[model samples]
Target: MSTITLNDGSPVPWLAFGTGTALYGKDASDFVKVAIENGITHLDGAQMYNNEETLAAGIKASGKPRSELYITTKLKILEPGQTATEALRVSLRKLDVDYVDLFLIHSPSPANKEGKLKALWEEMEEIHSQGLAKSIGVSNFRVEDLNVILEGAKVIPAVNQLHPYVWKAAQPIYELCKERGIVIASYGGQTPIVRAVGGPLDAVLPAIRERLEKTRGEPVTSGQVLGKWILQKGAILVTTTSKASRIKEFLDTKNVPDLTEEEVHVIEEAGEKLHKRIYMRHVFE
Candidate 1:
């Protein structure tokens, strides 16, 4: 798989293995090792996930050199007077890594009550300068939240990680990130199929799948069609699955035939028919 060059000049895999709520507090070493075995070099973790210890276990199990892995972790909710530097120091100890490929502000302060975005980002830049992190970015940030940081940020955020489900995708935010050279990482890569199980895509996805299967001379699943849609949109994908077979299916999306122009529009049009958002616990609210 090819890597997406970030604005900071760092490379991240187009597909990432996510240890979100699904693997929270579980021994993910086995899962992590499985992901690595299946060509998933990017592992996404977070302080809030509370699974870094096991995350480390998985990395160790993979037995790959640290240099070959692209690790991403995020700072938890910012407390008053908190700094990204100190936060990252704590995370480093937990992950047992001297440096991470990417780090991020987990979320904006509750309605930005503490008003620490400027202070946090300044320290984030400082952390990058110290070589603690290769790139710095944000998660769950709306356009208004980013505007506040853009006002004084010297280093443009390297990426923005959010749900970005097709139905509820905010096109303006995607375009905004594109303009700023901030790559988008989507955590909800399979949401279109998982949550909207029988939605409009069901009607058309099967036909698209048949066309792809015939062209590729292999089996095609609806999930791959959705994954291709997200991949074609230039957004990095972070998908989580405990099953090995499912992991292979997701990684194989790299080989799936590209969606036709008309097929792409069909997925988007179906998404607009019903907007379903799964992430609602926003600190920015």
Candidate 2:
């Protein structure tokens, strides 16, 4: 399996199965079962999604040993008077797992985004120390949010999940993550194509896809091209597909040759022309 070695030396698969808003509380188990059967072993979930039981059920249905799977979930909110540790314990009960391979603070605290970031991160560090979470990270966190955490952080986050598709490249934070050995788990790696269908990439991707298919001797897709771009940048991909065929297409990207550096530049350069942001909402809102 292709994996990225996190800061703590644990491995996370390059292709992750995601349980996002659309699948919350509905058929998460069924699709997760599909994902597992199709060779997906990493699951990305969250406490805010209200579907931990569904995800838990999916894992049970797959019958894959807990040790064989890499599971990740996040702390959705820090309610009034609730500590980060307390919030995670509630998630543990819902997930029915003693320890998540990766746990994250879902986002910067919206109410007082900067005021509490450092302290919340410290609390996350404590959860990691207790072995309740094997690794700790953050999601949808921008560069400014990170500056505060880094000030007094005893443990640097192992990963940072961000929406870095097309125009929303998140360069500053992306560079910061690399300099610090923080693995990036890209959630919208393929969203631009999904949203743009016949947009800018269509003009250039068909030829690149054709060239790559020749290189690998297998059918290559625009989705795969986008995935390959993310992969070539040495980032992990968080993607979801409810259909079996689509799941296979996602895994198939592994066999193809890496996109040339120029090709990657071309795609991003094209994306820069169509700057847009997705996944900008705070879950608490």
Candidate 3:
């Protein structure tokens, strides 16, 4: 799998198998095992998903060495009197690992609303200092939230994961992260194909796929087209599905032909015709 280098110098897999959404609050053992067996080396998990133990189970079932897998989990709001270190230790126990490749604040809502985003980030820095997580970051963080943390932050965030469709492209956030060397990790990349199927992309994706098929001499789906678009834009993709074939399809996206500049423009223009935000709307609002 291709990798992206974080600002902190950690190598992150460009495509990660996310253990959320469909696997949320459920036993992810079977699905996670299947994903690993099919060449997915990066696994994205979280405390909020309520399935870290099951994710561990799947990891064990896959029989891949811990050193070979790049594991990541997110931190939820700290409990009463609970330190970030304490919270990460809990996640580490659940995941049965000494340290995670990456750790993130699940959302900025709690800390931002409580007026403790800076303090929360201080604690995250503390977690990194203690060697509990190789890298630390924030998810669903806006430019405002990032500013709050960056103002007092000693360690620049390694990444900021969010949904980045063309409609809500998050250009401001993208620009800030780019200036600061923070990589953008994208989820919900297929919102146009899955959630809002008949948007402007419908008219454009087919032709792009046909062109890519001729270049690569293979079939390409709209989903792969979107995934390739994300990859081409230099963002890590966190994607998941219950089906093995779908997992293979997503993995195969690495070989899909890149989108031309006009094709990318067509996608961006189509996305602008309508607005859609499938997950974490409050973060953008």
* lDDT of candidate 2 at residue 26, scale 0 to 100: 66
TM-score of each: 0.94, 0.94, 0.97
In candidate 3, how many Å is residue 55 off? 0.4
| Candidate 3 root-mean-square deviation in Å | 1.2
Backbone clashes, candidate 1: 1
Instruction: For model 2, give the 10-residue run with minimal summed lDDT.
Output: 276-285
- Please identify model 3 stretches exceeding 4 Å from their true place: 166-169
Model 2 reaches what TM-score against the true structure? 0.94
TM-score of 3: 0.97
TM-score attained by model 1: 0.94
- Most lDDT-accurate candidate: 3
Model 1 ranges with Cα > 4 A deviation: 79-81, 166-169, 283-285
